[model samples]
Target chain A: MPKLDNYRVPLKGPVHLADYDPAATPFAHGTVKAQEKDLKMLNKQLAQLMRPLQGENKRSVLLVLQGMDTSGKDGTVRGVFKTTGPQGLRMATFKSPSKEELSHDYLWRCHAVAPAKGEIGIWNRSHYEDVLVPLVNRWITPQIAKQRYAQINDFERLLAENGTTVLKCMLHISKDEQRVRLQERIDVPEKRWKFSLDDLTVRKQWEAYQQAYEDLLEATSTTHAPWYVVPADNKLHRNLMVNTLLNHCLLDMQPQYPVDYPELVGLQVE
Target chain B: MPKLDNYRVPLKGPVHLADYDPAATPFAHGTVKAQEKDLKMLNKQLAQLMRPLQGENKRSVLLVLQGMDTSGKDGTVRGVFKTTGPQGLRMATFKSPSKEELSHDYLWRCHAVAPAKGEIGIWNRSHYEDVLVPLVNRWITPQIAKQRYAQINDFERLLAENGTTVLKCMLHISKDEQRVRLQERIDVPEKRWKFSLDDLTVRKQWEAYQQAYEDLLEATSTTHAPWYVVPADNKLHRNLMVNTLLNHCLLDMQPQYPVDYPELVGLQVE
Candidate 1:
């Protein structure tokens, strides 16, 4: 069951994080104990599609991830939201900004934590780190990183015309698997508070952040937010390819459960 | 291992929510499959003490919970944080208070999501429902519910003198177990969007919300935030007594990890 349209990323491209093969496992099929028992049966079918996507509070999903430093993105969000528990999950990490989140407009702190309306939202490192750290520290300008990739594809096409689904990934790893995960986070003294000397000056700009992630994965692969590219050097095939691309985007958003409640169908709670 | 100081709530006197026995499973010792294998080994040792309490960013833990209306507080936060996944967990959920959270105060949207530092916050129906739905609908007075239980014990002793470690819980179910969980959420059509005919007008003011939870568990049981009545009608002994009182307050806050990086000790990541 591999065709995640062969790791997407092709909206008419010139994108080459050197033709992707971060130790490829094309959506792993069998053994690593059967892709961790199919990532615990797609993390209990993403905790049963996050309870009718938070009891059908209309719609929202987000995801986003992106990667590189230890290319696991907090181990694919703790192995694909280990049973979607932090109730309707909202996790937003985006570090390196605060001064009142650089006084706005950097998608204003990723649109002030986006996923609402029955939430799932998980960014971790996003708003594509404002065009990959100001276009790999030339502090912006490749025409302001192509106008922040058409203003992040017009702010993810206004969150997919207001019902939000989004889902992006990148995780791709290698450059000798990030020098063996930044030298096992400096010989693992409980992973030395996730090592930094600016992660060895961003691992000496590993080929300029892989050419600023192949020019923002070829200017933000769009059709209302599409990205993929996740081979992530097998941390269980990057948490079984981002939990099978977020259980194929919540089984194509079949989130229901909001039963109209015909006058509480023979009501009685006395 | 029952003595969580015999279900805590004692910082001085009279808190009889009928002396707590909502189907008591004194922290359920054996078999319900060995207390669901000791709640999956205390949810993997509380996800390994949430990575050194988020790499010792310097203490924090909140919790809160409170109860009634099918007293399971989202199934004890989906069974004791089903393996702490939403990175360093923050939760929140308060519910009724808008018009800009009833124009401030009522612990101003719970001191704007309190747990910062090395996070673990979770409220789920808190600021003790601003003193239980305005002192059980008399809508304030009882001297502003005794000045909001001494301003929620000086706002949880200013989040326990700023390093935060609160811990509240109250879950204690049984008005015939909330009439068999509100009649299995009205005979379950995918639990009919969690049925609410204002949950039967708060189940006909259940003894004035159990005498406003026996006067806020006898005036906010303190010693800088303590309160635990938790019998909770055996939903696996209310998730093994709030995951064994949050793994005994993260093993008495033994959160360490920030190893003062000695100039990257023989450092080399190139």
Candidate 2:
């Protein structure tokens, strides 16, 4: 297995999307079947870790997933968290901002849904969208985009300073891989609901979007909440890598069941 | 397996808690191991049903759970929903009302969190707590309790008429069962956080709470939203019964993927 740190974007350097191979499966060390079995085991371990995390009730984890359409953000969530109890996991999906949301600062909506202590919050598309979408469409000036990057870093630092451990992943997929996935969505009848004409409009700006991601990822990768770019063309590899990243974060936190109630040690219910 | 309707509280009749046996495993048709296997199958089917439900995005389901302490509400959620994707399931846990909550009508907090279209909402404890706790403690007179029951029925009707299928389950466990479960929480260090001295105070009013439950169940069991008394003393049996009930409900709803999109046929992403 490759070192996870290799995937982490360095805090002080430029990040080139070309350096990461979307088709690489560095974390999958064995045959396809074996890699699947490992994903199942990792999922169970994650479920076990969730109990103590909720019991401790003093810290939280936030997983920010940013990816192009058909890059498997939804699939990653379903695959990785299939074994977890719904009570311990909170999921928020951000699409085009509503009028009310646009009325406020972009960060305002994200902050309102930030994970509370003792919960693991999943943001399917997050505040980073504020930077990505506007920049790709030339809606925001480059200077304004740079300012937003610093603002986002400060926002994440505030969460980390308080008990949140933020783990962000950019699901990196090749343009050809995206073409295949988008075709599947269009061709499959049951998946037709997920297909929107707007996806094509966004796909046309693929190169511009890639450039925006590269710039924002370099600017926002911080000591407190660094970004890890996951090679996501292989769907199973994407799930496995994200699950492993989350499991590692939880283990490091070392959440334990609270043990401070001396008064109830021998108390009997009526 | 026993007929599920046998457990349904009738809309036109009085509900007698003594008539139900908490320890009976009517739904557990075979050996313990076999029943456990069936639960796994049911969980998988529920997970399958969730996708189409979300794809249709027109209807929803709300599951309301109410019971005395140690009746296993939390355990039921963890067991039944273990296989579900977190995105499709929205869980709301209502504890004691805050000062702001107290200032509003009892149902305000519940209304704010009702499941949106295409989601399954689980209430760990619910607005029924308003009827249960207050009436048991004599904080509300019988007349007001009757009024609240009517109000609750009307509130649930609005949800059903608007496409939310409501399923309420009362986890009925005997006093002896509660004694054992509460003791386990005290004896088990990891579970100690769940114990409270106030649990004992409430247990002392067990008969009063039971009476309150019977009265409310009879009054609130409407055609649109009915209540099922789940036998919950045997933890495995409780899980099996609830899972089966939910599976039956979802199957009856017959949620399907939308077939209305004609604009994208043979359309290719550029």
Candidate 3:
């Protein structure tokens, strides 16, 4: 099956987000089926690539997925990563750092959870928290923390230089979109536990966070580790775009089997 | 394919483990095509049963497996958990507590990582550290630490009473068998990183640790949250036993689809 070049949207800049309205985005994309089929096919190819890489243990992939609460980070993980062989996949979801993490550098906590060689580590929320939450809370002076942006770029560049393929996604959603989601959580008895007042406070500072995110993206979007600002107004679109990026990244890695292992020739099933 | 009746091995207290070696229990179950076929069949049944239960979201399963270093924790996870659906399954591995964790109550750190409803959480090593490590290091009195075993049981009972099914495993390997495996690690450059001088130090206290573990298993294993003692002499046996126990747990849960969700009957794909 041919890959869908036409469906691939050009990388949008920060300015393009002006038209963003999560609720306004139509989820009934005409190409949903085709796109999903492509994702499945791409995932199969990725599985084939991943098998040999497990034995080689040379490179590690860090998949950093950052998004607003209820913007489908968990769903994206479920859909895209469901097929990757379990052995080499490591997932680290960062919660609030512990007291020890506060004593040292912010990156210290993240450093401990980085994926090992021949592994794929999913960071549900990662070092980006240093920028996002601290910036939102005014915990650090803008100038001092601005240095962290470069530090992060260097850190990611170091990872890439030392054989890590970093795929970062920012799941973007509008304020109105978040309100609807928050309401869904409140209204749906099953989802009540997921709702929190802090979600509303975060939604209130949406624009400030957006500008902070935009600057962070502009500063750190290296050729080695590009950040995809995913439009997450439409959950379907968010899922699709994230899957596309993941499929693309895995395909780019082109993982191959170690040559030393004995090749299966005529081994028969008993 | 039919279900294999549970393979029961009779092992009584403190058998002079130094006499028995891995060679004595070399995986003699050769060419297991039929067994493999039955396993696959059982896995499909288990997955089918688990699919809908995720939506019901009434209960979660916590699988905690611990053993001496190189006792096949990762291998068991790989073998037994291969077929679980990604949506409802999560895994958390606890290494030595970071400096931050040391300051807090031991259970506090663990609480942050517990599985949500309708999920199966796998803890590679867990809160048992409060019991095991502290006791090993003489950081706490055995009397105080023995209280922890009761605390753990009650904690699990709380989780079980409120919709969590906890299944814990202790992989039992003889000292002679472990020495052979440790030797393999030292001889093979690839596995050398896994071996450490600390492992030998721990080996010296193996009997004390074994007694500690026996007390732990005896006190904590209950009907709601039973402990599965797996023989780790043979990797294949360990893997198969783990797979069977997991199969049984998922079967017992009998997860069904939430009745609230609309049925997929005549929906158009295109």
Candidates ranked by lDDT: 2, 1, 3
TM-score of chain B of each: 0.36, 0.98, 0.82
For each candidate, give its TM-score against the true structure: 0.37, 0.98, 0.61
Of 1 and 2, the candidate ranking higher by lDDT: 2
Candidate 2 structure quality by residue, lDDT tens digits, B1-270 = 588899999988779999999999888868888988998999999999999999999999999999999999999999999888698888898999999999999999999889999999999999999989998888999999999988998999999999999999999999999999999998898898788889999999999999999998899988899899999999899999999998999999999888877787778776
- The interface RMSD value for candidate 2 stands at 1.2
Off by over 4 Å in 3: A1-16, A19-35, A261-270, B1-244, B247-270
Correct interface contacts retained, every candidate: 0.79, 0.70, 0.06
Question: Taking the tens digit of each residue's C-alpha lDDT, what string does model 1 give over B1-270?
Answer: 678888888888888888778898988886799899999899989989989888878888999898887798998998998977888888888888889888778788888888898888998888878778877888787788888899889978988998989989889888988988898999888887877788888888998999988888888888788888898888998998899899988998899998778887888676
Q: What CAPRI class is candidate 2? A: medium
DockQ of candidate 2 against the true complex = 0.75
How does candidate 2 fare on TM-score? 0.98
Show model 1 residue runs off by greater than 4 Å: A1-3, A8-51, A54-69, A75-85, A89-170, A180-191, A195-244, A251-253, A258-270, B1-53, B57-60, B67-85, B90-164, B169-192, B196-198, B224-259
**Largest lDDT belongs to which candidate?**
2
Interface RMSD of each: 7.0, 1.2, 11.5
Ranked by DockQ, top first? 2, 1, 3
